[model samples]
Target: MRTGLLLTTLALGLSTTALPASAETLHLFGPFKDEHGATAPIKGSASAMLDTTKNTLTYRFEDNGLSGPVTAAHLHGPAADGQDAGVLAPIDGPYTTRMTGTLQLTPEQVKEVQAGQSYINLHTEKYPDGEARAQLTTDLTGHKHHME
Candidate 1:
C-alpha cells in the first residue's frame, strides 16, 4: 500500500510540472485622430494573448475610417505613450481594416511588453507615419489594456 501511494504522488508531481503556464489576455483599443498625432480619422481596437511559456504572442487588430488603404502595421516599443520607438515586430499587411498574426518574441521583447512599453501602429498610404496607434498597459487588476 505504501509503495502504491508513493507512485501516485510521483505521478501527480510529474503531471503538474508538465502543465502549461496560464496565458495573459491583453485588451487594446484606440480612437484615431489628428490630436494624438495621426493625420487621419482612423479608429480601431485590438487584443492579444501572450503565452509566456511558449514565448509566443497572438493578436487580432481591426480598424476603420482610414484615410487610405493600410500599407503597413507594426509593434513598436520600449517607449511610452506620446513617444515613438522603432519597430520591434512587423505585421504582414495589405490590410484594409483588419490584420491578425502570431510572433515569437525574445526574452527582452517579452519583458518590454509586460512593462507596458509596447504599442501597435497601423500605417496607411496617406499617413506613412501612422494612421492609428495605441499603447499596451495593465490595469489595477493586472488585466492588460490597450489605451489610445
Candidate 2:
C-alpha cells in the first residue's frame, strides 16, 4: 500500500508538470516611417503586449516632428512591408507624444497579429495617406507558442 501510494503521488506530479500554462504573453515593436508611397520626415516607435488567454492587447506609442496634426491611427495588416491594406483596428487620438491603451481583440484578429502581417500606421493632416508606419514583429525574447 505504501509503495502504491508513492507511485500515485509521483505520477500526479509528473502529470501536473506536463499541463500547459493558461496564458501566454507576446510582445511586438516597430519603427514608423512614411508608408504612403511618399517621402516624409515623420518618425515614431511603438510596442505592445498581447495576453493570448485574455485576448487583450496593451500598447504604447510615440512620435515626433510630424508635418501636421495626427488625424488617425490604426493597426493595419495582412500585408507585407511597403504594401498597404485596410485597417484592422482603429486607434483613437489627437495623438500626443505618447499614447497608450489596452484593447480586446477577436480570435480572428489575434490570428492575424500572430502571423506577423500586421502593421501600425499614423495618418496626419498633411498626409492623409499615412505619415508614419511600422510593421509589428514578434519580440521572441521570451517563451511563445508556435502558431502553426
Candidate 3:
C-alpha cells in the first residue's frame, strides 16, 4: 500500500510539472445529439488554453465519427442551451470536419469565458447547417481530464 501511494504521488508530481498549472489544458467534450430539435450524431473533443497574461485563447479541435460530410465548423458565444446564435472561430477546410486555430480574445471576451460564455459547433452535409455543438465553461476545479 505504501509503495502504491508513493508511485501515485510521484506520477502526479511529474505530470504536474510537465503540464504546469498555469499552462494546464481545459478538456472539452460534447456529443452533438441534435440541432433544431432533430436527431444527429456529432462527437468531438477539443483542448482549450487560455493565456491570462495575453488574454488569448488557443484551440485545437477535431470532430470525426460524424454522421455525414463536414461543411463548416466554428467557435461561438455563450448560450444556456447549445445553439448557433454565437460564432467565434471559423474552421478552414472543405469537406473536412477537423479544426485548429487560435483566437485572440479581447478583455470582454476573456470576461465572457470566465463567465462561462463560449461554445464549439460543427456543420455537416446531411444537416447542411449545424449538427453538433458544445459550450466551454471555465474550469477552476481542474477535474476535467484530457478527452479520451
Which regions in candidate 1 have their CA more than 4 angstroms from the true location? Answer: 1-16, 20-37, 140-148
Pairs clashing within candidate 1:
none
The better-scoring model by lDDT among 2 and 3 is 2
Q: State which candidate, 1 or 3, has the greater TM-score.
A: 1
How well does each candidate superpose onto the true structure, as a TM-score? 0.71, 0.75, 0.62
Candidate 2 achieves a global lDDT of 0.76
Candidate topping lDDT: 2
* TM-score, structure 3 vs. true: 0.62
Residue 115, candidate 1: C-alpha displacement in angstroms: 1.0
Clashes of each: 0, 1, 1
lDDT of 2 by residue, 1-148 (tens): 9999999999999988865686677887777677655476655677888777778778788777677778998888778778888888888875786888877788788777777778888888778878888777775443232221
For 1-148, candidate 1 gives per-residue lDDT tens digits of 9999999999999988876676455544333333245555556666666666666667777677777777888888999877889998988766757667897888788878777787788777677888677666654343333432
Q: For candidate 1, which ten residues in a row score worst on lDDT?
A: 139-148
TM-score for predicted model 2 compared with the true structure: 0.75
By TM-score, rank the candidates, best first: 2, 1, 3
Global local distance difference test of model 1: 0.70
